[model samples]
Target chain A: MDFQLSDDQRALRAGVRELLAGRFGRDRMRAALDAATGVDRALWRELGEAGFFALRLPEAEGGVGLGLPEAALLFEEAGRSLLPGPLIATHLVAGSVKGAARGEAVVAVLDAGQPVAHLGEADALLVLAPANAPRAPGGTLRDAAPVRDAAGPVRSADPFTPLWRVTDPVEAGEPLPGAGRLREEGALLAAAEQLGSAARTTEMAVQHAGAREQFGAPIGSFQAVKHLCAGMLVRAELARSAVYAAAVTADPVEIAGAKLLADDAAVRNARDCLQVHGGMGFTWESDVHLHLKRAWLRSGQWLTAAAAEEMLAGDLC
Target chain B: MDLAYTEEEQEFRARLRAWLAAVLPGLPAKPRPDDWPGRRAYDTAWQRMLYDAGYAGLHWPVDAGGRGATPTQHLIFLEETERAGAPYVGANFVGLLHAGPTIAAEGTAEQRARWLPPVLRGDEIWCQGFSEPEAGSDLAALRTRAVRDGDHYVVSGSKIWTSHAEVADWCELLVRTDPAAPRHRGISWLAMEMDAPGVTVRPLRTLAGSTEFAEMFLDEVRVPVSHRVGAENDGWRVTMVTLSFERGTAFVGEVVACRRTLAALAADARRNGRWDDPVLRRRLGRLNAEFRALWRLTQWNVSEAQRAGSGGVPGTGGSVFKLRYSHARQELYEAAAEVLGADSADLDREWVLDRLSSLSYTIAAGTSQIQRNIVAERILGLPKGR
Candidate 1:
């Protein structure tokens, strides 16, 4: 069984990396972060043109004929570049929502109990009922009425991702068919992003360790720093295997485990990466802290550690 | 990225499963851990069965008188065998996995003719004599000396951590042949007969109270120069050849066994009311993810080996796998102990024995600390530590 990425898949990932590097490089990302900008419409449309949102849509439906594995790879690149906005939500709704596949409309999904992300920039909103809530007879997606007045943007831990609290009781809307599947897919995608962050932070840590010197030698030559970098690689690689395997299997339990590991890897690797960077990692000018903050924010989104752990534990019993 | 096995690979698996099912029932009861002769006989008989069935050396090259199975087929072989409760390589481990392969790669034609067949046929057993008391992680610093005299090398000094030496027909011996040369450049590899005069094998008891390994002392042991695997003062490089084989799919069978152990632990927890504790359940759950990820990592490595056409050499990725799998194994047994509660202290229990043995995982093969150095310097391009 060939479980490694195919040449075509590698090309797809490289293509995404090239696209991101050219369009949303580090300088551009820093600029957006500093300016506190919302979703970039131009960049969003460009990603849509690249078939990012419609990656999993069937070719018969006039969309890119790909699978969740490919989607995971692309989102990994998104995560590596720290590309912001409601990327997963928009991509999840691309099959159902008009213009979403083409990136003309930005879709923001709201879980019943959770805050809405990118509520202001979203051209359309899809509200998902809480998993435990009762469902309507025939599940269907109803166009949600504008509830912008219900919430205002709140300060976000991740500067690139804005959050809003819904003060009013927004309608649960019709229960989307396969809501569970949607949530699992969302978790898997989020996990893929976390895998990307883990890997990126590992690279950042290794690069810094090799260049930064102390006590007449590169810090990397010290056992302490070398072990930290090595540990990051192990965690990232482990999470990567889980993420890719889950994408292929699409099993609920596997996805849950993948999320659990990916979340841990991303958050922990970022912290270790910061430690490797030493005092410079503490400064805002360095990208290390941003990764840590973003990882912290992402770890709590989609399927959280507690929720994923419970799901996995239930499987064991 | 297809995880599903090819039709041919599936057929291979089915055949192996059926063979295992048919043969396992007729096998003798397993020997006691302390019974070296019984273990040697039992393990070698199993190896003979595999040899007769053309299943021995499943991953060894065809030229080496093996089945020449692809990495995927080899993985399937391991998965099915471990699942069927078949015996491990055991006493033949050094012969089949280490010395035989190394001889195949670097041995002379006469060497292959004399040594390779017995190893594949289970007619001989081999033990590694590479690590000495003074040269554990720093293996090249071994003080084992072998002075050349005529056509024989008069060997001296001792080796530690040699498994199966008590019953081993041969020792894959590493000796310092040049006293004046550099540590790594002065070594040589030899096939020293265990029955040779002045060779000694003293069984060493592990923390698990098993005599699976021994301390081997070679005092003026005369080994023919023809027994050498490679050139004199080149044992270090010869040893490096075996390291590649060790890393790739070495833990594959162990991963399968660990998954089974984890399942049994969960079942035990459920029966004993330990499952009611959310903390324990979550701990087991996290371990479940860890092992699951490790299995996937194994697949990834095998796939990579297949792609690189390196004949199943998994490269530095093995270091990555070893670093985690070793610790994960320890963690798995620790979780088992937690589920066992007070019963964990009972020496008679299998879990207790396993938990004790698990302590060596991080320290054995290559210590976790050494593994990290390899990963950092090789995989991550970090500068080597002084």
Candidate 2:
């Protein structure tokens, strides 16, 4: 009945955090944000070398052997660092896509009729057709042909995330076995990332509240600000429980619910964090808005709130 | 990261389930809610059965004449008992949960022998006399004075919200022993006999219209100094210790019951065609997620307690659980009202009655506002509000 992170898992999380901090810390992240740079291929390959993409791959396959829970933890750190790329898609395709396990290739998934994120940098694009969509005759994974591009790269709310409109009458690639489950896994990972952002924003809020003074006292001493910070912690912790539990259970309904809560936590926490910081949070120079924008972007990714609600309601009704 | 129970814990669960199945049906029908004496008889008989079956005090220390079950085993006990429709700790709540544990932790050998056994056996039920009319949230401000006089403390002051006082044999009383001392330091904990002379219990009717709790008046009640659990002027710390006992798996049984109620609410919705409403269905679905997540949070807390080796005191996470669980409970009953429509106003309906009782969840134990302060000041390291 031990439902906490094991000693080994704790080490794994710490290791991932250290790696992300050393490689793509806040300074580097801000640099990319300022420059509006696309995905850093060097960091991508470094992450591959670190076995980030192949975390869940079998040890027999020359990959780091782990499970979804470990993957969730690692992705949580990635989310905390706001490490941007088609990480989930590339990780999902690690076993099937050549060179993906080593970060030599980048894979992106197109689903729910949304624009493909990081498509220009992606070596391979997997179109995960909606379950209700008519089955196409070809594979689900395909080469990223320019012909598939309906529109050029568009500005994204999250500056780190690049997006491209994929053409309609979208051609599906080779059949990906367990594609439905893969979507659920994607949702879980996305939820884990949101959990990380939620927690990070909470820390940022608390740190700011304790340091920022107003009316001759630390703003945190005020019940209004304190309660906001408290509420953020509650949301983040609750979402964390859901995300971690869903990772272990791998149940679709649970995953859907995890996504729903994680989205709420991330988006709402970021907004509250902004409120806590007062005027400073509104400036682009501050990281608070970045988190809010990113959370907004991520809320629409993988499993969305409306979709998750319907899925859970379907199970209940 | 394992959530599965060990083979031994699983075996414990199975054995307890079988025992509950065998014994529960043979018990007498439940007494009326207002029947204090009948309830005392029914609840104590159930506690005695648990004692005889070796299930009483599942989490108390072995040296204190308990089973000395691990935190996991204790959780399993709660989960299985609640699932099997077993009776709650009812009249024996204060004795088994609050006063008895306090005594075990701080009482003398003579005190243990005199008090602990009766509590474990349900022979002497206990009630809490801590909150006063003037010192509800700020309990340390209680003016429940008890002047020392030889071997006895001449106590005189009132305690409010004393649950089960009508049937309680003993009241776990807190008194201000040193008026000049600090607010937190001037207090002392005592086990005053509820039947003591000049002690009065006036049952207080809750919004739910139940007299399960009362206002207790202690008019020169001479409680022996030997009844004190800890040293004089240290009752505040003793009260804090008692509160820590409530953190980890305290609301676990309630979570199970809430889940059951949610299922019944869903069933009711389906029968009444309220399930067709997307808003209501989604609300229930969201609540399901809330409860499921709360259950996971419980497991996390228990695992943390096990790791910290704190003997099942779950630290500040209890405030987190309490803060959310209280609101979630209120939200669940609100959803039930939506499903019930106009019938929700009918007090005879179980959900209607529960909906009323759920109102106190955020107010009782610790108010949600108090919980927020605990979470902020204690857990988040926010500066204390002036």
| lDDT by residue for model 2 (A112-136), tens | 4687888887788877767444233
Query: Is model 1 an incorrect, acceptable, medium or high docking prediction?
Result: medium
Query: For model 2, how does the per-residue alpha-carbon lDDT over B343-365 read when each residue is reduced to its tens digit?
Result: 99899887999999899999898
Model 1 residue B110 distance off true place after TM-score fit, in angstroms: 1.1
User: Residue B184 of model 1: what lDDT?
Assistant: 89
**Tens digit per residue, CA lDDT, model 1, A1-317:** 89989999999999999999999999999999899888999999999999999998889987899999999999899989999888998898788788889888898877656777888888777776454433432223544446666687678877778888777767655555555577778889999999999999999999999999899999999999999999999999999999999999998889988999999999999999999988889998999878888788777777777777767777775
Q: How well docked is model 2, in DockQ terms?
A: 0.72
The list of candidate 1 runs beyond 4 A from truth reads A132-145, A174-179, B310-314
Scored by lDDT, model 1 comes in at 0.87
Residue B104 displacement in candidate 1 (angstroms): 0.6
The best candidate in terms of DockQ: 1
